[model samples]
Target: MATNNLINDMIITKRALPLFRDTNGFIKNIDRSYDSYFGKSGAKIGASVNVRLPNDPVVGDGPVVSPQSIAERSVPLTVAYRKHVSLGFDTQERTLNVDDFSGRYIEPSVNNLTGSVADIAMTLALGAANMVRNVDGNGNTIAPTSETWLQAKAKLTKQHAPTADRFAVLDPDTDASTVSGLMGLFNPSAQIGQQTKTGAMEAPLLGVREWINDQTCLVTTTGSYDSAATATGSVTTLSNAGNAIPGQISSTAYPQNSVIATSALNGGINAGDVITIAGVNQVNRVTKRSYGTPMQFVVTQAVASGATSIVVSPALVGPAADGSQNQYQTVDALPVADAKITLVGKQGETIRRNLLFNKKAMTLVTVDLMEVNKGVVDCGMANLDGISMRTLTYYNGTDDTLGTRLDVLFGIGVLRPEWLCIVPDIVDAG
Candidate 1:
């Protein structure tokens, strides 16, 4: 694949990443505006939410005091690692028609790619805060119920998360339950039922608008999630400042199993931090083989003082991964260099990760445009809903063939970590 030389890349190319007409669900739900990130590497993305100041401590009677001036706290945001999707196709076969090229292939890919990116971003964010699971009067944990939604809402309420933008992303199982009258928000009688009579169910249960993210919803976890760090070691000490990713991130002293280590990036891991292990995924069902994906863990401890190796709670690995049983282990291994980590909070045990959060809890931060090119077919700057893409086609001189590719690039940045929480464990049809 050649680098996109927009200068040489010619016409018949469009910049926008077209999407499938039907699956615009995630696209319409997320708020994307380039007012901040455009033509830049990154920026300080945050907000000064309010003007109120902390209450002053009281003292015994004293002399007259002067007025004080204070500013609301400022929150900071950063772009996440860039993401992309690329494809190659026979140039002549697709020359049939541009719209045909887009509708048949590009649109569906773009739509799915967009949703997958959002889902991955949300997955990464789940580690930030895990919401409690709902249990019946019996001790058994139940699927997402009114109790689960309330618990998720409580997490944000304690953090002072704003009320207006609050939302809940329910998994399929829980979603079905809610729509089936479990939420206790609507009734078969009354005006609310009239909305259903017109063939639409009322949303915004418990003041949090609802969105279903089945395509990219979470279905990942481990057996022992609550155990504190079983083993601890100092892989490296994080230096406060550096121009690079910092030696602390790639320290050789770090052992292979899931153990405590220091975070050297500007955003280091903190207590209660639960992040996706780099290069890991949840257990795959098709093969009944977990390729060690969606590896997640809790941060039992973080040290900003003296030495700083985080205490990743729970024994991450055991005799299971060590060939004691001669079986391929899930989470192939512990996290590695630049494992994209998001503070998605935490959650109670569940197979599916249903979540409720404020809209401001997380964001897809855009950085540079990811485009593809070869010879003369040119496409330039184009974007949609805060996402940009480019495609190119040219002749393969050596193979005597022609080819084309399409791709997009962006990052995921969580603005407020505590504003979101995961409702773990909901059943999935797949």
Candidate 2:
């Protein structure tokens, strides 16, 4: 029997691209450059690609040229998420033209699939260590304002994030509230026009083009931990004291995403909780100067009750005594014995995460899923602008209907956590 040429998989994938791109606010803006390394065949889900980050530069005097070993670290981009949407077509529906069929089915399925992909990337915004707290310096809950964007931009700038291609993804409520707050009669005519026309901050506000995404993630509760806890005073490193040794900086220094033991953490820490340690101020990424503010961290692993250690991101590497490892250091000093630990939010409260970030800060890599045996089964596969989606059709003998499944395989990773800042909006607790 001749297969129905109208139900081609490649055709469906092509029809799906416009909806997919327009629907995902965060995914479309992220770094998809890693997709260039993969091809049409044999791309396994767990396979990884090493993403290279630029090394920090050093200053030199005029006398003689000094040689420095290249210091580089890579974040592995793995294709681990495989998400799909399935639908069935009866004899009557299959007879419709491709455009008609797409309007009925493809639009809704791609919209849903885009939300799932965006949700995965939205979680990275909550895990950001640098944040514009929901409260002001005086400690009152507040919606974001123009100053908030400036503060977030300042954080990104101090981290050496690229000044170009900045974007902001706001939760639905934040989008409305921020627009109301910034569109006062005294504001710029152009900004007011943008807000009045779009009903949201769609234009570049403080040099960041803002987008409203309903799929933004929320923090309904934080990790339960004692507010007055202290570090267990044990630094996990090889030879030096949480500092880098002369020749073995990467091996000797405390690494990011490593576990640190804490004392009086009777309630333990949650994976998304943000915390800070006393006297551990964040240093400027380029100049390595202390910002005089406590360095914040996002817990990456959950700790059970009575557990002693918590895993944190953006590792606690202090400046070495010799000053040679300043390029790799993140903190001004290691937590001293009994250093106070500070938790950001109360447990069981709700807050929506609104992300403000540079394009280079986050990445989304999609690989082409293996196509089905064309001679055996009808299938279609296509790649558009680095996003790969495939469709497969099979007959249900009992129901006398054909079913189609659309699938996308991809992964999400944070290239520079410091470049991403969260401007949280308070949500009333239930």
RMSD of each: 14.9, 5.8
Quick one: RMSD of model 1?
14.9
For residues 261-284, what per-residue lDDT tens digits would candidate 2 score against the true structure?
Answer: 777576766666778888889898
lDDT score of residue 269 within candidate 1: 43
lDDT of 1 at 226: 30
Residue 316 lDDT in model 1?
A: 42
What are the lDDT scores of the predictions, listed in order?
A: 0.46, 0.72
Report the error of model 2 at residue 93, Å: 1.5
What is the C-alpha lDDT profile of model 1 across 217-239, one tens digit per residue? 66653333332222222223221
How much is the lDDT of residue 53 in candidate 1? 20
TM-score of each: 0.58, 0.88
Q: Which candidate's TM-score is highest? A: 2
Span of 10 residues, lowest total lDDT, candidate 2? 243-252
